[model samples]
Target chain A: MNLGILIAGLLTLAIYSFLYKDNPVYRAAESLLIGLSIGYTLVLFWQSTLFDKLFYPLLREHGIWLTIPLILGLMMFSRLTRKWSWLSRIPIALMIGAGAGAAIPAMLYARTLKQVSATVHPLIMENGGFDISAVVVVIGVLTTLAYFYFTREHKGVMGKMARVGTYFLMIFFGATFGYTVMSRLSTLIGRIDFLLGDFLHLLK
Target chain B: MNSNKTRWIIYSTLLIVVVLSYLLGINLITHPSPEVQKSYTFIENLPESSVVMVSFDHEASSLPEIQPISLILLRHLFRRNLRVVGLSLFAEGTAIGYRTLTKVAQEYGKQYGHDYVFLGFKPQHISAILGMGESIRGVFPEDYFGNKIEEIPLMRKIRNYDDILVVISIADGDRTMQWIEYAGAKYHQRIMAGLTAAMITTYDPYLASGQLSSAVGGLKGAAEYENLYGRRGMGNRGMVAQTAAHIFIIVLIVIGNILYFKNRSKGGGNR
Candidate 1:
C-alpha cells in the first residue's frame, strides 16, 4: 500500500473532476499543484544557485571573482523600493546584453544558415535519381516565403503561391494539432493506468 | 438534449470506453520510426566507454511520456558501457534525471560515480549550454546530491563537450532547439532528442538539417524504443487506452460534423 500512489490518484481525480464541472475540490488540487511547484522551485534554486554557487564560494572557498555576480544579484533586490527600482535595470541590462551576445550568432547560424544549406540541395540525388521530395520542399519553402512577403501586393502569381503556402501551413498545423491530441491522450492514459493499476489494483 | 448534457455524455462515454479497453487489454503493435532507429544505431556504434551527456530538458508535467523514453535511452547507454553525465536544464528535471539515471544504473549493476554522474540542474540554460561547451564542471560545480564535481570520477574525466561524444536532450518543449543552436551549432557536438509528440513537428526543420541526429518522440516513441530494446514497459501498457480514447474522439468529431450540417440545413445556425 503506497501512500504516495493513493494521494496522487486522489489528486488526479480532483483534476479530472473539472471535465464533469469545476468544483472546490478541483480548485484546491489546482492551487496545490501550482503552489507546490513554486515552493519546490524556490527551494531548488536556493540550494543549487544561491547557496552552492554564491554563498559557498564567497564564504568557504574565499573566491573573489564571484563577487561581481553576487553584487549584480543583490542589486536586483532594488526593484522592491520605488527610489532604487531603476538601479535594478543595470543588472537586467547586463543579463540581457550578455544573453543576446552569446545567443544571437548561434541562433542565426543554426536557425537560418543551416536551414538554408539544407534547403539548397540539388534536385537530383547523388545516385542520379530525381528527388521528388526535394522538389516539394523547394516549392513549399518558396510558397511559404511568398506568404510572408508583405512588400509586394499579393496579386497574380504571388496570390497563387500564397494560396499554396496556406495549404502547406494548414498541413503543418493539422499535423501539430493531431500530435497535440495524442500527447494529451497519452497523459490521460498514464493517469488512468496509475489509478487502476497502482491505486485500485484492478489491473495485473 | 441540452448542450451541457451532451457534453457530459461524451465525457462519460469516453471514460467508460477507456476503462473497458483497459480491462480488455487491447494494445496496438508499435514499431520503431526511422529517426528512433537512427538514434539507437548511433548510440550503439559509439566506441566502448565513450562519454555521453543527457539533459533532462523537460518539466515534471510531461513525465508520463518522457519517463519511458529516458528510461530506455539510459538502459541502452548503460548496456553499451557508456559513461553518462546526466543533468537537467529544467529545474524539475534535476530530481527526475537523477531518479531515472539511478533506476537504470541499478538495473545494470552500475555504480554512480564510476558508471554515471548526475550534474544536476543549471539555471540560465543557454549560458549553461555554452559554458558546458567550455567546462561542464564549471557550469555545474556540484552534483544533484551536493557532491563536488571534482570528486566524481566521471565528472573528473568530462571537462567539456569535446570530451563528450553526444548530447541527448529528453525534452517536451523548445529547450532542445536551444541545445541545437548553442551546443550543436556553436560547438559542433552531436545531438539527439526525445520529445513529446506535439513537439515532433516543431523540431522537423532541425532534424531535416541534421542538426538533430535523430529524435524519438512521445509515447509512441517510447513504445517503439521498448520494442527495439526487446522489453515492454509503460509505453506499451498505455497504448490500448489511448487507442480507445482516440476512436471515441473521432466518433465524436464525426457526430459533431453531422449535427453541424443538419442544423445549418434547417436554418438553426449550427445548433
Candidate 2:
C-alpha cells in the first residue's frame, strides 16, 4: 500500500507538472493513458459488439450472413499493407453511407425543426402573474440569434440591438467556457486528490 | 517603490486565504443541498412500477458525472420496483453504464430480465433512436451481455416509447434535447434530463415549455440525487471540488480587475 501510494503521488505530480512546463514525464504519462485507453476500447468492442452481436450469432444460427460483416471487417485491417489499402474503401463507404442515412433525417427533425419550434413561444402569465424570466429568455434568444446574422449590415437601432446581442452572447460563451474549465479541472483535481488524499495519505 | 512589493505580498496573501477558505469548508456550506430536495420531489411524484427509458448518453470522459447518476437512479428505480430499460447514444458509455447498472441491481437483489435490461449501444445513433421508437427489438436484437431480446422478460414487455412512463436522459451534449424532441415530444414520454451544469441553461427552455417534467443539472443535480438516496457519492465530492475551483476562479478574476484599475490609476506604460 505504501508503494502504491508513492507511485500514484509521483504520477499525479508528474502529470500536473505539465501545467508549469512541458517535459518528457508529462508526455510519457499522457502517451501511456492514450495507449491504455485504446487497448481497453478494443477489448470492450470485441466483448460487447463483435463477440455478442456477430460471433455468437454466426456460430449458433445466423451463420453465413454474419460472415459478410466479419469478412468486411477483416478486409479493413488489409489497410496495413499500403498496396491493398484501397480495397478497404468498399466497407468504409458502406459504413459512412449507413451513418449518413441515419443522421440526416434525425438531425432534421430533432435539431432543425424541434429546436426552432421550441424557441417560438414565450411564456405569458394567464391572469395575475408575470413571466419576467420568459421575457428575459425571449430577449436573450432573439438577441443571440440576431448576433449571428452575418449577411446583413448593422446601423442605428439595428446596430445597437446587435451590440447588445453581442454582450449576451459573450456572457453565455464565457459561462460555457467557465463550466468546461471547471469540469476539466475537476477531473485533474480528482487525480490530484487521489494522489494527495488516498495515494499519498498526506491529507488524511 | 517598496509599495509594489507590499502590493504583491498582499495579493498573494489574499489568494492563499481564498484558496484555504474554499478548500477547507467554506464552499460546502455555500452551495446549498437543493439537489436532494429537487430529486426527492421528482422521484416522489413518479408512479411505482412505471416503465422508464434510461438514456445513458455520455462518453467515458464524462463517467464522473454520468456514473453516479446511473447507480443512484438505478437503486432508486429498483427500490421503488420500477422497470428500467437502458440504452446508450454514446459508444463509450455502453460498457461503463452496463457495469454500473449490474452492480447496483445485484446489490438490490434485482433480477436482470424481471427488473432491468441493458440494450447495448449502436453506432447509428439517430437511426437507432428512430428505430427504437418504431420497434425496440429491431434496434437491439440482443442485450449487452448477448442475451436474446426474447429471452429477456423485461425487453419482451417493452415495445416502444409509449410503454415508457418516463424518459431519463443523462448526457453531456444536445443529445438529451434530441431525446426530448423525438421521443418525449413525439411519443409524449414524460421526460426528465440530467446534464452538465454548463449546458443546463441551454435546455432551460425545454424545462419551461413543460417538455421536460424536471431536470437535475450537473454535479448539483447528481448531489441532490445522492442526498435523496441517502448516499454520498461522486457528485457530492465533485461539488466540493467545483466549489473550490469556482472560488479560485472568482478570486483570480477579482485580482485581475484590481490589477487593471491599479494600472489605470498609475498610468502604466503598457496600454
Candidate 3:
C-alpha cells in the first residue's frame, strides 16, 4: 500500500463525509487542510521572500542597499503593536503610490485605449457590406455604459436602452454562472478519477 | 419530497453517473476553439530551441483544472523542442509547477539546466513580472533548487523578455490580467493564458484588444487542446463525466420547472 495515497484518500473521504452529515471527522479534516495551507504558505514566504530575497541579499549579495526594502518590509510588522502602528502607513503609502504609478499607464493602455480603439471600428466593412456583429457590439457597449449612467433619471429612451443593457448583463452573468458550474464539475471529476485510478486501481 | 432528501438524491445520482461514466470509459467529442488553435499554432510555428516562459499563476485549489492544461502545453512545448523556463507568480504553484515540469520533461528525455529550468516562486507578482522584463536573472538570482541561475546553461543565454519568444501564464484567477497589462501591454511581450472556466469572460476585453494573444479556458478548452495535441489525457476523460453531469443537472432543472409550473396552474404555487 502506498501510505501517501491511502492517507490522502482517507482525508478526501472524510471531507466528502460532510455530504451525509456535518460531523467531527469532516471538521477535523477541514481544520487540518486549513492549517496545512497556512503552514505551507508561511514556509514558502519565509524561504522565498523573507530569507532568500531580504536576508540573503542584505547579508550576502547586494549588501547595504537591500536594507531599504528590508526596513520597509519590517515596517509592515509594526501594525501588530499600537505604539508603532503609524510606521505601517509609510510603507502602505509608498506601495499605493508605486502601485498606482506603475498600474495607471499600463491599465489605461490595455484596458481603456486599446479597448476603445478596437470597439470603434467602422460599421461598414471594406467590401461595402454591413457588419452586423459590429452593430450588435456597438449597441451592447452603448447600452451597457448607459445602464451605469446615474446622473439622470432613467426615463424614456434612456430607460429602454438601460433595459436592453440589463439583458446583455443577464446573458453575461448566465454565461459566467454556467462556466462556474462546468469548472466545479470538472474539479469533482478530477477527484473521482484520482480515487478510482490511483487509489483503488479500478480504472483502466 | 423534502428539500434535503432531494439534495441527497441529486448528489447520489451525480455520483452514480460519474462513476459509471468512468467505469464504462466514455469519451466525449471536443472541438477546438479559435483561441486554443491560435496558441497552438503560435507555439507550433516557433523555431526549435526558442525559449518560452511558463508561469504557474494559480493556487493549489484550481490545480485539478490547471494541471492538465499545463501538462499538455508542456508536452507540446517539449515536443517542439522548445526550451521552457518555469516559474510561479502565485506561491502555491511553485511546487506544483516544478512537479509538472519534471514529469513532462522526463517523458521527453530532457535534462535539467539544458532543456529546461524552473526559476521558482516570487512574491509581489506585479513587481516580479516587471523585474523579469528588465532582467530575469536580477529577479531570480537562484533557481528553485538553490542553483545559481548563472550556472544553468539555459539561464545563461536568456536575459530578459527580449530573448523570450512568448510568455504563457497558467492561471486560475486575475494574474493573467496583470501579465497582459504589465508584460504584454508595457513590455510588448506576447502573452497567452490557460485559465479556469469562471474567469473566461473577465479576459474578453484583453483578448479583444489583442493584449492577450489567446486563452484556452475551462475543461472544454483543455479537451480541445488535447484534441489538437493528438493525445488523450485527463481532459478528454473528464469531459465524458462532465457531459453526463451536465445532462443530469439539466434534467433536474427541467423537472423542477415542470413541477413548479404544474403547482402554479393548480393555484398551489409555493415559489
Candidate 4:
C-alpha cells in the first residue's frame, strides 16, 4: 500500500530480472544504486572525515600542526592534473610507509607469533588426556608449512608429509567454502525477506 | 536438460522453499555454539553500569547479516544496564549504527547523554583506535549529533579505554582485527567481535590466542545469541529459511556431482 514499498518492490524485481538476462530496467537500477552509493559516501566522508577531523580543528581550535597532513592530503588531488601528477606519489608513499611501519610489529605479534604459539600447544590436554584436536592441528600446521617449503625437494618423508598437508589444506578450503556459501545465502535471504515481508507485506 | 535451464529450475525451487518456510513459520531450534556462549556469558556477568564501547564497523550492504547481531548485542548490553558508547570507524556505517543504537536504546527507555552516546565515524582508523586509548574526547571532540563531548554526561566519566570494561566491534571485515591489534593488544582492553561468517575463520587465530574475548559470527551466531537472550527475533525467523536453503543446496550439489560423473563414465576414454 505504501508508495515507498511499491517503488522498492519494482526495483527489487528489476534487479532480480538480471538472472534471466540483462535489460534496461536492471541497468537503471544498478546505475541508481551506484550513484546513490557514491553520493552517500562522498557526503559521509566530507562530514565525518574532512570537515570533522581536518577543517574543524584547523579553523576552530587553531590547530596549526594539522596543516602538514592537510597539504599532503591535498597533494593527492594532483593526480587530476597531468602536469603535477607526480606530486600524488608523495602522499601515497607516505601512506604506504606509515602503514607498513605501524603494521609490522602488530602483525608479527598478532598474526605470526600468536598463531605459532597457539599451534604449538602441549600434546596433552589440561584434563590429563591426549588432545586429539591439538595433535591434528600441530600436524596440519607443520605439514601445511612443509607443503609451502619449496626451497627443498619434497621426496620420501617430505613428500608423504606434503601429501598429508594437501589433505588438510583441502579440508580447510572446503570448510571455508561452506562458510562463504552460508554468508552469501544469508545475504540472499535478507534480500528475499525485504522483497516479500517488507515490500509486499506477504509475510509477518 | 541444459545447464542453464537446470540452474533456473534449482533457483526457482530454492526461492519457493525458502518463502514457504518463512510463511509457514518453520522455526529451527538452535543450540548455542561455544563461541556464542562465550560471548553471551562474558556480557551477562558484567557488573551493572560498567561501560562497554561498541564500534559499528560495517556498511549497509552487509546490514542484513550484521544488523541482527548488532541489535541483539545492543539489547543484551542495554538490558544489563551497561553504559554504552557507540562509534563507527567506517563512513557508511555511521548512519546505520546511529539508527540501530537509537532504536535499541529506546526499547530499553535509555536516556541519551547519560546512558549512551554515539561518537560518529572517524577516518584514519588506526589513528582513531590509538587516539581513543589516550583520550576518547581528544579523538571525538563532539558526539555524532555535534554536541560538545564535555557536555555529554556519559562522556564526562569516559576519558579513555581504561574507563571502559569491554570493546565490541561489529564488523563485516578485518576492521575487527585492527581493534584487536591496537585496542586489545596495546591498551589491554578486552575485545570481542560480531563478524560476518566469511570473516570468522580469519579471526579464529585471535580467538585462540585469547586476544578476542569472544566472537558472535554470522546469522547462526545471531540466532544462538537470540536464544540465549530469551527473545525470538529476526535471527530465529531467518534460521528456518537458512537451514532449508542449505539443505537444498547440498542436495543440488550432490545431484550435480552424480550427473557429472555419470556423463564422464559414458564418454569413457575419449573425453
Tens digit per residue, CA lDDT, model 1, B1-271: 9989988898788789878888887667987889988988898899999999999989888988888899999999999999898989898887888889999999999999999988888888988999998988888888888898899887787789999999999999999999999999989999999999999999998999899989999888888888888888888887777877888888988989998999999998946
lDDT of 1 at B105: 94
Of 1 and 3, the candidate ranking higher by DockQ:
3
lDDT accuracy of residue B193 in candidate 2: 72
> Which wins on TM-score, candidate 2 or candidate 4?
4
lDDT values, one for every candidate: 0.89, 0.71, 0.91, 0.90
Q: What TM-score, to 2 decimals, does candidate 1 have?
A: 0.97
Measured against the true chain A, the candidates' chain A TM-scores are: 0.96, 0.79, 0.93, 0.91
Q: Which ranges of candidate 3 are over 4 A from the true structure? A: B268-270
Q: After aligning candidate 4 to the native by TM-score, how far in Å is the CA of A43 from where it should be?
A: 1.1
Choose 2 or 3, whichever is better by TM-score: 3
DockQ score of each predicted structure, in the order shown: 0.79, 0.25, 0.80, 0.68
Ordering by lDDT: 3, 4, 1, 2
For model 3, the local distance difference test gives 0.91
lDDT of 1 by residue, A1-204 (tens): 888888998999999999978899999999999998899889988888889888988999998989999989889999999999998999999989988898889989999999999999899989999999999999999999999999999999999999999999999999999999999888777777788899899998
lDDT for B155 (candidate 1): 79
Q: For residues B35-80, what per-residue lDDT tens digits would candidate 3 score against the true structure?
A: 9999899989999999999999988778778888999999999999
Better-scoring candidate (lDDT), 1 or 3: 3
Q: In model 2, state the lDDT of residue B88.
A: 82
